[model samples]
Target: MTWLILISASLNALLGLTLLLLWRIERRHAYVRMWGWSWILLSVGLTLGVALAEPGLVGLRYDLQALVASFSLMGSLSLQVAGARDYRGLPRGRGRGLPVFIAMMVVIVALAGIDQRFAVIAGASFLVVGAWLCAWWMGRGGDGGERFVALCFVAIGLVHASGPILDPFSRSPITHTLGLYVQMVLSLGLLLLSVRRAHAEARRQAERFEQLAHVSLQGLAVIQQHKLIYANPAAMTMFGLRDEAHVGRLDLQATIPPELQEEARERHRRVLADPAARIEWEGTRLTTDQRRLYVRSLSSHLPWDDAPAELLVMIDDSSRQKAVDALRRQALHDELTDLPNRNFAVERLRELTGHGAAPFALISADLDRFQLVNETLGHEVGDALLRAIARRLCRQLPPQAMLTRLGEDQFLVLIEETRDRAGAQAVAEQMMALLETPFAVGGTELYVHLSAGIALFPQDAADGPGLLRAADSAMHRAKGRAGAAYIFFDSAMNGATRTRLEIEQALGRAIAAREFLLEYQPKFAAGSRKLVGFEALVRWERPGLGRVPPVDFIPAAERTGQIKALGELILELAARQLRGWLQRFGRLLPVAVNVSPLQFEDAGFSARLLAGLQAQGLPHEAMEIEITETAAIGHLGRVLPQLAHLKSAGVHCALDDFGTGQSSLTMLRQLPIATVKLDRSMIDPLPEAQAAAVVSATCALGRSLGLQIVAEGVETETQARAAEALGCTQLQGYLLGRPLSAEAAGELLAGALSAV
Candidate 1:
């Protein structure tokens, strides 16, 4: 019996150490630590019982041995119950059970002092209850390992319960041997349960990872040893693979383009060498079906099957790249002509003028009379004509030159390596010569002309904008010439440009100050020399400048859009003067006011003019609107409607500067006019046979149309007589009367009425 007790103590000690080792490996299993302490306490209790049985062998007090053995047995049972509760995830009830356990230990110690047999029975009762509780807790909803542990505890409780019944006075070898076997079985069951739970958790985690990879949109793949080991659904579709089997057979290097294979190998080496490496790149790849794809991919290191591997995520970027390229082109190129636009020209100029650059020339070209084509033949034909012109210019350009459209009717050319003014001039001339030929547009043979200006680097101006301005100014100067021409920029043009700008600015102030006045030039009958009507002319006198010539300011006013306001002022003064004359003399002579072409483009011009005349309480016939032949012919579509409206309202309309325009016969026939004022050029050469014949033929044409012919610029009596003999009904020049002030004209009108 003593040997059995020693062997059971050793076995319990071994089981306790094994459980403690398992607990150290997995600290989260705190119930294993509690169970290990319970086994250690049971081993000490068995050892104490052996010493109490033979005090001579251990040389210890019998009473002390019996008391410690009783306490150890109770402590071991309490711990078993607590550990069972912990394993079942239930509260240990330490606060309620602690006093009860102390009372049980006190009763057992008191019982041992009376008789050792009573103490042993008391301790065995506690073992029976605690072991039964463990069995019930462990077996409830338990697996195979937990059920086996419950059975072992149940057998242990029965063996200890019968030990006190069978031999209450001595130790039982059979009972101790059975307890050792039960404890060993419990430890094996615990180890089995822990391993099974770990395997189950691992399986659940793997399933979650598989589901996430299958549903991901980004292409995901794993490459090991330069061969495809794993591929998700997205990766298989991206590479045009039929199934997972297809992906498994493919080599990673085979999917890459031949030119990019070396790059891929280098990247793979980097990923394997450093576990934290992440590489991002863009390249082309070949699909399984031999289709090329533009892809952006991210590569990073991944551990797969306990070995280093590469993980790649890819995105198709073909469409996005193409869209970006298309947007860039639209921003820099002209939509209509498909050429580089002004923005592109400016950017190129900036690049060329950076730090140190070779000398280049900028040529500005403007199409002459392009507006006339648009107004006459329709804008469709005009657009066609511009396209034709662009194509011709491109064909004529040298390989080193670039042409860009600077908006409507304007183009810019850049020539590199231009050495001097002559080089620029030659290029401009060559470009201009390409337009001398007629272009067939919309079934019409249209002749086009170009006016070009040349500005050189380090010669005309310094920077891009300055060069552009210089070229534009020179172009305007060339446009002022008689025919198609090209000119180089000079310093004098800048002064002229500045002066024009000053005039434009001052004109705004003059209009506000009302510093403008009207002068009337009297018209007379060719035969009777009788006063007929007057032509009201606008004249400006700045307070400090005294007077600005009409030629200098009129063109500026028209160009700067100041003519509209000036025209309104002239209408108001003329209407007021006519009203004053009618009140004083009880008669009124018609006054002709000149209108600019731009003013007629206003949709409300006729309505505004009629309203003004009516407001002044004057008849419509008291105001005759005069338009130049060039204005009437160039903007015939816009001028014709206004003329027709005024003619219907009983207001007279006359074509001024008639013979200087291109189509005199067309204007006479199409325009609703009451008179035709011959230009000074036609009358200047009058009385000459050829000039006389031309004037005579014009007068006959006018008379046949029931129109009055007024010959202008008749300086001498011979010219006046020649005009009268040539079937002229009216004459207006210095010979008849000079332009007079409002006061002088009013006195002259009163004198004429008194004479009548």
Candidate 2:
């Protein structure tokens, strides 16, 4: 028994020395270091007790006995702790472990005076520590190695607990032997734990690698010696291949397109030669169904997998890149014509400017009859015409010329270099000639014409923005030409344009400030030439600006969308005048106010007109609205509904300037027209045998349509009599009475009522 005890103790001392050497090599776990010290102490104390084990021997050191007792218990406690910690990677509990162990050693030395009392104390401490270790490992349902270690700790704990009772049955040598056997068993458990721990670590690492390979967004793969050592699930999906055995063995070049194989090879070479290099490419790959896929591939150096290798990460940019390209097209091109838009034009101009391509000519063009086209036909036809014109202009333009749509009905042409003004003029002339031939648009043979203005670089102005401005100013000048013609930029045109812009600003201010007034032009019964009603013509009287004619400001107002407010002001002023005339003459003659297309299109127009009538204490019946054929034809859908609403409210509507527009009597039947005002052109060809026939025919048509006919621009009595004979009862012209101020109109109404 003594020989066995001695042999086991020596073996434990060797195991402890091996642990200490392993800890010094790699101090990964602090618990291993603590257990090593414990084993060494236990081995040394047991060795000293054996050497001094002669019973009743003289000079038997009491301190040596106490040390032996304490070291034995402490060694078992350390084994229990090491197993607990190894099961779960726990931190070193209480950083004061070393100091606390030193203090315990000092106390044990002081207790050496007691007989076996220190052994009892040491046993109790081991019981508590071993019990905790048993609980920890017993709860772990995993790891067979850990369960085996837990049972070892439990047996040692039981032995320590029963030490006091078992001591009565045995002496110190017997108990020491039992403790040696337990330590030897604990050492074997540590050996099994170490072997199992290495196996578990390898298994866990393999599982994590498999998860990464199966569930990753990027197509990850490691290539070694021109062969794929690993291919993740994403890699198979990206290459559009099934997870076949051959796929993992295929080289990178085999997966790429034949045309891109060289690129892939070069990329791999670059990554291998320079580990820091990050290479990327826009590549095409075949999908499972052989559908081509566009993607961007990236490659970088990967850690050596037994050889030089590269890591490839592929990102599919197919759908997202397509959407980005679509957005870019929408940004730089006109959606309707597919031509370059304003921004693209500006960018091209900048590019040209940067290249020192001076002495170039910029021509600005505007469609002359586009408004009439939009008004007579529809916006659909208008858009078709614009696209047709864009195509036609492109066909006639030279290769050096770049054409762009600056905005609606306006285009820009940039000529690289102009030898002289005639070179630019010749191109503009050719474009104008092409428009002379009518375009068949929407079943209508419509004539399309363009007016262009030419501005030379370094002559008209400098820079892209300045050249465009100058060209636009010249374009307006060309519009004032005899026909659709081209003109060069002149300073005077800018002045006129400036004055026009000033008038537009003034019109807006006048409407906002309520600074407009109305003049009355009376309409009479042609049969008796008696006063019937007054035409309300708007007059803008800016304080120092005097009177701005309706012809000048009305068009400006309509262009700027200030017509809605202008229409409201005219209604208000006309209502006021009508009310005053009724008070003085005791007659409520209807007042006719012209309505613009823009004003009629306003959704709030009817409500506002009715509100004005109510505020002025006037009936809707006393107000008549005169709309040009353009207004009715342009927005027929909106204008017809608005007319229906106003007619329901007892307001009168008449089609004014009828003959000037192309709308036939068929439109008159659809419209809610109380009267048809024959345009001044109708009277121009009147009072003659031929004119009388046409005039009488027009009146007959009006009568058949259930509409009253009023002849406009009647000057002579002969014309008035002819109109009356032709069945037109109402007549309006300067011959009857020129436009008069509101107060003068009141006197005129007063005299007429008195005469009646």
What are the TM-scores, per candidate, against the unseen true structure?
Answer: 0.62, 0.53
Which residue pairs in candidate 1 collide? none
**Candidate 1 local distance difference test against the native:** 0.86
Across residues 330-404, which tens digit of lDDT does each residue of candidate 2 receive? 998998888899999888777766645668889999998788888989999999998998899898889878889
TM-score of 1: 0.62
TM-score: which candidate is best?
Answer: 1
The list of candidate 2 runs beyond 4 A from truth reads 1-76, 85-111, 115-192, 215-218, 222-230, 243-317, 343-362, 374-380, 394-402, 414-447, 455-467, 488-496, 507-756
Give lDDT: candidate 2, residue 725: 89
Error (Å) of candidate 1 at residue 579 is 3.5
